[model samples]
Target: MSEKKEVKDQFIIAYLPDLDNTQTIINNAICFAKMLNKGLILLYISDKAYKCVSITDAEILLKELSSKITGIGFHSYCAIEGQTKDIINKIPHLLSGVLLVSATEDKTNAKVKEKLASNPDIMLKNLYTSRIAYFISSQNLNSNLPFNKVVMTIDNMRESKEKVLWGSYFGRFANSEVIVYYHNYKDEFYRHQLHYNIKFVMRMFDNFKIKYNLHLSSNSKTFVDYQAIDYAKENNADLIICQTTKNKSWFEELFTLKERKVINNSQQVPVLFVNPREDLFILCE
Candidate 1:
């Protein structure tokens, strides 16, 4: 007989009723947790008020959920609270590598009676923004999400490159493509500056002639934000990468007009925030 391997004690996951991208999110998180040899906690918080749901009934459901995520242990909590995400916020905070795993649906439009039917994405999104007690609180700690590509926005070399590298590394791990939008907003960079930036990017890759998509971005003046979101939407990108860094300095946070627009308007795609140090910026400075 083989001995059961005990999963590590650092992971935690939440399960919502709607289960929109819940499974997808669950699968992704489990893969990450497994790699780190961690166990997970499964939580289900119902926003729907019920006068008859007993603790035993909820436990049965949780037992079923636990079977699916094998070796990943779980628990269930049913509250009288009516807000889902708010309920999630109230789960006991686990220190160490403890994390909150949540899911959100992509709801571009709202229907009259959404609660009557199940829409996975909408359900999860509702949980995140739910008004229930804990959810409304700032209970969720650091979050780790998978992403690839940064719509790296560049107008002049005013933005620091080292800053967004963490995001780029994430993209690399996902084996995804990154599109850097060089803002020739109204006018192009100094001919030499454009040449250097383009050539410099080549040095970062395998030195192969990696193909890039260039946009003159005519509507940048009035709608750079809209344009960036539209591009990410059209391309099916999971997240838009942005970094803030000090001008004429090495690396800093991704803080600027274009970066801000990318982060703010990234609709379905989350924004990855990164900050790099000065030594990382300079070429052996």
Candidate 2:
């Protein structure tokens, strides 16, 4: 008999800051963890320089939250008292096998600055790691869970394959339908590339026996990310899965990248952002 390979400990990290949307974030995190059949880590990170919640209080809060998981017949760990970057750096496996779920709001206005000072997106960028992240907004608190409908965006870039893989994974695990949106580029070279990507996407989905719908953009001039979000809203999609920018220009850094804009879209749909890396993690059976 062949020896069974041991699966490493894989988990979904839910960043639960001391905010008004704590329960909402927890609920969404639970949904993903359950869907993926992975362990859950309820994480609360406070800067040592500026302590928002005392160590004792943070522990107590985590204890209470962990109880919620247990009640639902799932196990979870509570982590506190470390910087997000340092904790992730310390755990090498976390960089590869973990999925991060956190709440984010539009930080463009003065009103939300104080609340979003410890935003997970900022911490994620600083980690310089390529783990997948799912960002949920307050507007999506009431959205249906188990994500019955998922929207995936594909483009000419090879990185778009990651989005297709993730979408297929979701379809297989959550029994959800994936809606693929691709741009109809007018440029011959780009259009050929787009066709190649779509072919790969179709093949992968068929192999997985996943149900999917395809939509082509009428106007290729519009930004692809925005178009994906618009399609999600029109179709009442429960989630949108797309790739993160591989490189950010100076202007993008200042004005925010396309993925950021999708996360903060006016429609307020939840987004799953997959970093374009060769060694991106895939969920195990």
Candidate 3:
């Protein structure tokens, strides 16, 4: 008998009760997984308060999902688990590499009953605070693939390079146009420094042969998060990639709050949050 090949890292998709947006989540996950040459894992969890679904049912559903993604030149698996919070906490330790892609259906026009049937925001908060490389799909996506226009939000040139490095991979892989947006605030010295950093990142992009655009806002405008959201909408961007603000201390908690606001205001576009510590070399060919 041949020894089984151990799957190290995977792109995981959360399967909710309605499953209305599973295909969109799967499409993005597959594109990312194929780009990284990693496997895909479909994860389903049963809600105790809603339908009395068992692990068996979740497993069966996963099998059906597996059938749709088979022979895609990558290994795929299904995991039927309980409690999304627990799973999010343990994933980093359980797998060598993992990217969680979560999709939330839009309920703006749904009837009251249907709105009540959707998943709660508790797990969503957990995912954001977990510091994992994750993507949260906005509510009203048209279920498209190979995102043609992508936006990358950068705070400083120091961190902008990292953002560009990761964003370039998606741009090159999807053959998408990338726009780099930065907000100019604070003092001239800081603004000048950020511009230098942006230049540095642009140079790196040029060297890598990655095509992209740059946008910088003046300090007289609104909040940075709002500006970024507006720019994405104006461009009809399919995805917005951003780096989480560095967690320095209690004083820096505002960055986290701003990030949440940006996510909420994304207007149904997918947002990819890349952790600073994650290794990009493995993700790039």
lDDT for each of the candidates? Answer: 0.41, 0.69, 0.61
TM-score of each: 0.43, 0.85, 0.78
Which one is best on lDDT?
2
- On TM-score, the leading prediction is 2
Q: Compared with the true structure, what per-residue lDDT tens digits does model 1 show for residues 190-250?
A: 5456556555664664343333355556554654335655777787655454443333221
What's the true lDDT of residue 245 in model 2?
A: 80
At residue 21, what lDDT does model 3 achieve? 45
Task: Give the Cα error of residue 139 in candidate 2, in Å.
Answer: 6.3
Candidate 3 backbone clash number: 0
TM-score of 2: 0.85
The order of the candidates by TM-score, greatest first, is 2, 3, 1
As a TM-score, model 3 comes out at: 0.78
Poorest 10 consecutive residues of model 3 by lDDT?
Answer: 114-123
Q: Model 3, range 163-248, lDDT digits (tens) per residue?
A: 67667776667677888887875778877877787787788778777778888777436755567777787878877887666543
- Model 1 scores a TM of 0.43
Evaluate residue 69 in candidate 2 and report its C-alpha lDDT on the 0 to 100 scale.
66
List candidate 1 segments past 4 Å from native.
1-21, 31-39, 48-56, 70-92, 95-101, 105-218, 222-226, 241-285
